[model samples]
Target: MQRTTISVSGMACDGCEQNVETAVETLDGVNRVEADHTADTVEVVRADDVADDDLHAAIERAGYDVSA
Candidate 1:
């Protein structure tokens, strides 16, 4: 598993946190995700094949921001 951290924004509450997490979780090879609203970031465990751009796009689509 590959451990990754992506800074995020627009998470104003726990519900928004879940929304961000769910977006990351849906990607193939994503084993786990922990979204922190206070920190405005997320930790992800995924396969080596997971693309960073895809993840960022997903988070944006879910109504959040993913740092490039």
Candidate 2:
């Protein structure tokens, strides 16, 4: 598994955190996701071949901003 730290913006509360976590964790290559509302960061464990664009789009669609 490959680990990556992504900066995510616009998480207002725990619910938003859950939503972001769910979105990231749902990806095919994602093995785990820990999204912190206060930190505005998401740590992910992913299988090889998953691109950063996939991660960015997933978070954006879930109503957040991702820092590339």
User: What is candidate 2's lDDT per residue for 11-43, written digit by digit as tens?
Assistant: 989999999999887789899999998998999
Write candidate 1's Cα lDDT for 1-68 as tens digits: 78888999889999998998888899999999999999988889899999888778889999887776
- Native RMSD of candidate 1 (Å): 0.9
Give the candidate number with the greatest lDDT.
Answer: 2
Estimate the TM-score of every prediction: 0.93, 0.93
Global lDDT of each candidate: 0.88, 0.90
In model 1, residue pairs whose N, Cα or C atoms come closer than 3 Å (at least 3 residues apart or on different chains), thus clashing, are: none
Candidate 2 off by > 4 Å: none
TM-score of predicted structure 2 = 0.93
